[model samples]
Target: MESLEQKSSIARFLDNVFKLSENNTTVKTEILAGVTTFMTMAYILVVNANILGEAGMDKPAVFVATALSAFVGSLVMGLVANYPIACAPGMGLNAFFTYTVVIQMNHTWQFALCAVFIEGIIFILLTLTNVREAIIDCIPPLLKHAVTAGIGLFIAFIGMINTGLVKVGGAAVTLGSMRDPLVLLTVVGLIIAAILMSKNVKGAFLLAMIITSALGMVSGLITIPKGIISAVPSIEPVFMKAFSVSTSEIFSFDMVVVVFTFLFVNLFDTVGCLVGVASKGNLLNADGTLPRAKQALLADAIGTTAGAVLGVSTVSSYVESSAGISQGGRTGLTATTTGILFLASLFFAPIFTAIPAQATGPILILVGVLMASSVLQLNFSDPTDAIPAFLTFVMMPLSYSIANGIMFGMISYTILKLVTGQKEKVNKALIIISILFVCKFIFL
Candidate 1:
C-alpha cells in the first residue's frame, strides 16, 4: 500500500510538470514515445563517430562526444522549450564537416570545429532576434504543409537507404534484392508495423521495433552484443578542441565559407524538422506558427554550440522525433526521457548499438506515412499554391535534401507570385528569403 502511494505521487508530479492531461497523453505513453524516438535515431552515435573519425579525430572520443552532445541538447530542449523533439549531431552536416571542411579545404579538424562553433553562436543570435522564427512564420501556409510531407518523403527515403531496401542503380535508384535477409526483414517489419497501426495498438512503433529485432536475432540476422555495459570513454581528447584554432585560421576566408555553409544548411534543416514535426503533432498555433517558437529554436542553437565545444559537428533537432510524437508524445517529458537514455547509453553503448537498421527502418517509413497525410489538408485548386507544394514534397526525396526542397519551393513560389501579378500575396520576409536563397546558389 505504501509503495502504491509513492507511485501515485510520482504520477501526479509528472502530470503537473508535463501537463499530461492537457496534451491528452499519460506518463506511460510519453515514456513509450521517448523510447521509440531514441530507438529510431540511436544509429547516430556510431554514424557520427565514424564520419568524424575519417577527419582524423579519435573514434572513441568522438563517440563519447556524440552521446554527450545528444544528451545536453535533448535535455535543454525538453526542460526549456517543453517540446518532444530530440537533438543530435545531424547527419548531413557531419558529412560536410569531414568531407568538405576537413578533407577538401585542407583545414584541420579543429578548424572545422571552430567553424561549427561560430555558426552555432550565429544561430543563437538569429533565434534571439526571431530571424529564424520569422522565416518559419513567413513561409506560406501551403509550403508549411508541404514541409511536413517533404520531410516525410525525406525520412522515408532515409529509412529505405538505411535498411538496404533501396540501392543506387545504373541511373538513379533501384530496389534491394529480395534474397538479402536485411531487405526481407525490413519488409516484414513494415508489414508488422502496418498491421499494428491499423489495429490502433498503443506503442505500435516501439513494439514493431522489438518484435523485428527479436526476429532478426532468432534468424541470425543481427549479432547479439558481447555484453551490455562498457566503460564510459573519456572525452578529454575532443573536448574544447574547437577553441584551439589560431587567430589567422579563425579570420580566414575559408572559415567564412565553411561557417556560412554550416549556418545555411543547419538553419533550414532544423527549421524544416521543427515545422514538419510540430505540424504533424498538432503543436502549431492557429496562425500556423509554433507556440514557444523561440524556446524551441534555442534548443537546437544550444545543441549545436554545445556539440562544437564537445568536439562534434552541429547538433540539431532530429526528424525521427516524429516517431515518438506519433506514439502520443505531446510534451517535453518525451524529450527528457530520450535525453536521459542518451546519457545512459554512454555506458551501455554495445547494447544500444546492437539494434540494427532493419528494426528502425520500418518505423521511420511508418512515420513518413503519418506525416504525409498533411498533404491532404493542402488546397490544390490554385496553381500558385499547388505547384510549389508539389515541388516541395517531390524534390525532397529526389534531391535527398530537405533544404534543397525548401529552396526550390520558396524560389518558385516567389517567381509564380510575381509572374502571376499576385505580388500582394508575397510578404517582405518571403521576398527577402527568396533573394537570399538565390544568393546562396550563386555565391555559395
Candidate 2:
C-alpha cells in the first residue's frame, strides 16, 4: 500500500510539473508548439558565443551567459505574460554589437554592455508609460504587413548564410552554386514547406524541418562530427560580476548615438514581434491592449538588462513564437517548456553544436516563408495602403532594417496623402511619428 501511494504521489507531481490539466489536447499542443518555436530561433543561443568568441571571450563564459540569459528571460516572459512567446538576444542587435560597436567604433565589450542596460531601462520606461502602444498604433497598417514580411526575408537571409547557400564578398555577396548538395537540400526543404503549408498541415514548419534534416543526413550533406550528439552535465552558479563602463567613452556623443540606436531597434523589434505574435495567438482583445502587455514588455526589458550584465547584446522577443501559437499554443506553459529546454541546453552545448547549420537553416527559411504570407492581408484597394505596403515590403529586404522600412513607408504614406488632398485621413499620432522619424534620421 505504501509503494502504491508513493507511485501515485510521484505521478501527481509530474503532472503538475508538466501542467497536464484536464485538457490533454491543450497540454500536448502547447508542448509541441514550444518545441517547434525553440527549433526555429535556437541559433541565437550560439550565435552570440560565436561573435564573442571571435572577440576574445572564452567559450565557457559565453556558453554559460547565453544559456543563463535565455533560460531566465524566457522563464520570466512565460510566467509573467502567461503567453508562450520566448525571449533571447536579438539577431540584429548582436550584429550591431559585434560589427558596429566592437569593430567599427572600436569600443570594449563592457561599454557595449552598458549601452544594452541603458537601452533596456529606457524600454521599461516606454512600456510603463504605455508609450509603446502609441508608437505601435501610429504604424500604418500597410507598414505592419511589410515589417512582418521583411522580418521573414531577414530570417531567410540568415538561414541562407548558415546553410552556405550564400556568402559575403568585398563589393557584393554571391549565391552558392545550385549544384551543391546542401543547396539542393535547402531547395527540397522549401518545396516541402510550401506543400505542407498549402495542405494546411499542423506544425508544417516543424515537419518540413524534420524531413529536410533527415534527407540532408541521408544524402551526406549534413555531417555530424563525433561526440556532437552527446549531452553534457548541468551548469553551476558563478559569482555575479559588476557591470563596468569607461566614463570617457560612455560620455562620448558617438557612444550615446550607438547605444540609442541599439535601444531603438530593439524596442521596435520587440514591439513588432509582440504585436505579430499576440495577434496570431488571439491574446489581444477587440481593443488594442494585449491581456498582459506590461508583463511581456517587462520580461523583455529584464532579459535585455540581464543579457547586457552577462556581457552580451540586447535580448528581445522573437516573431518565431508565432509558429508555436499557430500550432495551438494558448498559455505560458509553452514558454515555460521552451525555457526548460534552454536551461537544459547549458549542459548540452555539444548537442546544439553538433547540429550542422545546414540542418537548421532550412527550418528558418521555412518559417520565413510562412511569415511572409501576412502580406496578403493588407488592403491593397486603397492606393494609400498599396503604396506604403509596397515601399515597406521592398525596403525591408533592401535596406536590411525593419524599423527603417517602417519609417520610410510611413513617411511616404503621410507625404502622399498630404500632397493628394487627402490630408484629413492622416492621424495626429501618425504625423508625430513621421516627424520624429525625420528628426531622428537627420539630427540624431
Clashing pairs in 1: none
The true-versus-predicted C-alpha distance at residue 119 of model 1, in Å, is 1.0
Quote the positional error of residue 75 for candidate 1 in Å: 0.9
**Pairs in steric clash, model 2:** none
Residue 386 lDDT in model 2? 81
Error of 2 at 30 (Å): 0.9
Reference-based lDDT, each prediction: 0.93, 0.72
Per-candidate TM-scores read 0.98, 0.85
- lDDT per residue (tens digit) for residues 191-307 in model 2: 887788789888777787778777876777775445534443222221122155667777889778977798777766777777666754556566555666778888998888787
Q: Among these predicted structures, which one has the highest TM-score? A: 1
